[model samples]
Target: MKVAALDLGSNSFLCLIVEGDKSGIKKVLSDQVKVVRLGQGVDKTGSFHPDALKRAKECLTEFKKEIDRHNVDRILAMATSAARDAKNGSELFKIGEDIGIPIEIIPGSDEARITFAGSTEGNLKGDENVIVIDVGGGSTEFIVGNRSKLHFAKSLDVGCVRMTEKFITAQPLSESEKQAVENSVDIALDSILSEVQKYPATDVLAVAGTPSAIAAAEIGKFDAEKVHGFILDQGKLQKWCDILASTSVQEKIEKYKIESGRADVLFVGATILHRFLLKMNKPAMKVSIKGVRYGVALEVLRR
Candidate 1:
């Protein structure tokens, strides 16, 4: 069956159509993403903004058209942090109904599980401890497991969009502001580090926007084939993190060709992953393009 999985992230929304069966994804049919900022202002307001809702309606309408083009057999659409936190998150249900694709708001723990499944789909060794770190717009899910069995899964409220909205104010962040962001992340991570480190992950996998943008910057361009399965060196990752903290948003766009929405929160997102590594004492993480949407598709197809 050809299934389409939609990840309605706080920072962006995506639709991925693929042909797959019980074993695993067999072939990719289409993949599309748009940085819609659905979580815009939700951190402070605790509700969806009018402008963000409008953008979501428009973006989802377009995605529906794309889904129709492929004649997908099923659509597994769902929302994350933004929708989960918003008081008017039910708005997504109406929008989904209007688009003829119902959407579900999944819990953070579930996000971690699916991300682990999707990111490590074919890469897992039955006995090796694996940790899949998925940094979305409003939250970051740290999932530690082995052989598809989850041992520790926690979602922290430290994400690119959430952090930038709450802490970042200017381009080329001031030292004080940079420290503030890291400090907050460290504090949140402190709660999970003890339990996460107990697993001693042999493979650390990173999914979602931050890693994708970083991989693109590392390769000097956006090439999916090159970005997927990309590995990060601790030194190089920290170097880029420093460079981003001291750089302007436009420079990121001009140099790496990332979308504006992503450019705004790229540094914060990278910092989350950086702090995760530091806190866990992990050297590096392998990047995976497959994330929530991929996991959603896998579940739908396998069913």
Candidate 2:
């Protein structure tokens, strides 16, 4: 079957089209993304802004055109974070329906499982105990497992956009603001600590944009082969977190070559990623370009 899987993320819309079967994927037809920022101001507003809805409409409509070109057998799309938080999420759903791409709002718990499924494929080794961290714009998913066995999975209400919206007011945040960002991540981690303790991970795999940007900055460019499977050291994560947090967003783009909209919340995202590594006491993490979209694509193949 030919499949198109959509990840309707808070900060971006990603689509993965693949040719695959019940056994596995064979060819990747196309992988595309657009920064729609669907969750813009959603953390405080609890509703979709008119511009956000317009962006969603434009994004999904364009995605449908792309999907049509593929002649796919199935199209699976899931809306996360912002959609779940917004009161008028249905407005975006209406756009999806009108555009011929229906949307399903998935809970964070499922996001964790799907994230794990995506990150682990071709990355795991012989029943290795692992943790998959998926940091998004509005939420972060912490998942622990051994091979295919999911030990613990939880989603925290801490993310780059959410943290930035809640506490940060300046480009170079004050010391207190940095601490506040850290505290938010820590508080969320603490809530799931007991459950996390039940399953200790041997390897850490981080997915999504935050880790991708960090890897690109460290590598001096956004090369997929260089970034994917890159082992990001613990100290380096902390180092980048502090450095990025001390600079303005434009500076991040100019210095790190970060994508424009992504630069704004990267520091907070770095903080979330680093703190989790520290909490787990892992020395380094492997970065994967595959995330929830990949997992959803796999699901379409099997279904």
Candidate 3:
């Protein structure tokens, strides 16, 4: 069967189409991503912004066209943190229905589980203890597991979009603003550190935009093949944070080639990952291009 998985995240909307059966995926038909910032003002306003909604609808329209061209046998669409938190988030489901796609708002725990499954797929070897970190736009998820079983999973309300809106207001963040962002990340991680410590992982695999963006910056280009399995150490993350903190958004876009929607929040996002890595006592993390969408596709095949 050919299956399509749509991930409506706080910062981006992604679609993955694959030809697969119960054994495994045979071929990847198409993969598309658009930074829609669907959680634009939801952190503060508690509702979806009109402009964000418009962008989401337009992006989904495009995704629908792509799905049609592929002639997918099944499509499973799920919305993450943004839709889960927004007061008017249900409207997103209505939009999906209108577009002939049904969108389900999944809880954070479920998000963590699927993220672990996807990020580790094709990567994990026998009995490897791995921790999968998904630093999203509205929330960050941590999952500790081996190749066969999941041990722990938690999603915290500390993400690029959320932290950026909450702490970073000025371009080239002031010392105090930077401190504030770091402090908040530390506090958020404080709640989960003990639990995470109980399940020590041999390797840390980071997924989603923040790690991908950082990997792209490190490689000087956005190539999935290179980005995947990339190693990002604490020193490198701190260096990128410093570079992003000093540069203007335009410079990040033109020089660093960061996505327009992600440039502003990139610093905070990297900081969150940095703090998480420090807390985990790991020097570096391996990047994974696969994420929730891949897991969703796998789930659809199972059903």
Candidate 4:
């Protein structure tokens, strides 16, 4: 089965095409993400900006073309924190309908569960207690449990794009500014920290844009073969944070060859991951390159 999954994210719009067979699945095609920053300022405004909406619609128009070219068996286009929380979400949906693509505004809880399912189902290896963490554009979702059952799940408003726009104003942020960002994460985490601590978990799995991009940067530095499901220690993650914090976004883009748009949010995302691991009292987390789109494909397969 060849399927297409479009993730309408706050930071980037991703379109994934995969070939699912009896043995396993393989990536067929991936659309280049246009950093529309759809959730830009949504944390404060409670609605999508007019410019962001135009950009999102333009990206979706491109994705719809690709879906048609591939003749995909199923097309699952889901929106996350930004579109889900926006006051004008219906307008966004109507825009999608106009483009002949129906959008699914998945709740944060469902996003967390689907992310966890993809992390576990795709990897086919991990401890019984796997803590799935997805550091997304607008929010972060945490889920801890085994394949059969999810023990705990929650979403936090600590996303890279959101945090960067909100707290990290200065380039290579000042010490005080950095502290402020950490404080914000701590405050937002307070409600879930207690509940997350109650769960008896071991292995930590991180799945989402931030973790994957961070792993890619680290791998580029080390010339690693593959970063999928790579076990990353807190020390290593801290090292990444230090490096990204020190380097200018241009330097990062030139050095790592990362997309210019991604360079800005990398540091903010790293800080969020570092703070999250510290709060969970976990030493390391395994990265999952696969995320919600893969889970959506799995759902299609099951059906």
- Best-to-worst order by lDDT is 3, 1, 2, 4
Worst 10 residues of 4 by lDDT: 220-229
TM-score ranking from best candidate downward: 3, 1, 2, 4
Worst 10 residues of 2 by lDDT: 105-114
lDDT per residue as tens, model 1, 177-278: 999999999999999888987888788889888898898888988799999889986876898889888889998888768778799898888888888888
Better of 1 and 4 by TM-score: 1
Candidate 1 has a TM-score of: 0.96
**On lDDT, who's better, 2 or 4?**
2
Q: Output the better candidate (2/4) by TM-score.
A: 2
Give the TM-scores of the predictions, in the order they appear. Answer: 0.96, 0.96, 0.97, 0.89
lDDT of 4 by residue, 199-250 (tens): 7777777876777778888777422247676778889889988888777888
Q: How many backbone clashes does candidate 1 have?
A: 0
Off by over 4 Å in 2: 107-109
Residues 103-179 of candidate 2 have per-residue lDDT tens digits of 88766557667778877877888887888888888888888897658888888888778888899999888999989
Per-residue lDDT, model 3, residue 196, is: 82
Model 1 misplaced regions, further than 4 Å:
none
Largest lDDT belongs to which candidate? 3
In model 1, the clashing pairs are: none
Which has the better TM-score: candidate 2, or candidate 3? Answer: 3
Query: By the lDDT metric, which is better: model 1 or model 3?
Result: 3
As for lDDT, the candidate ahead, 1 or 2, is 1
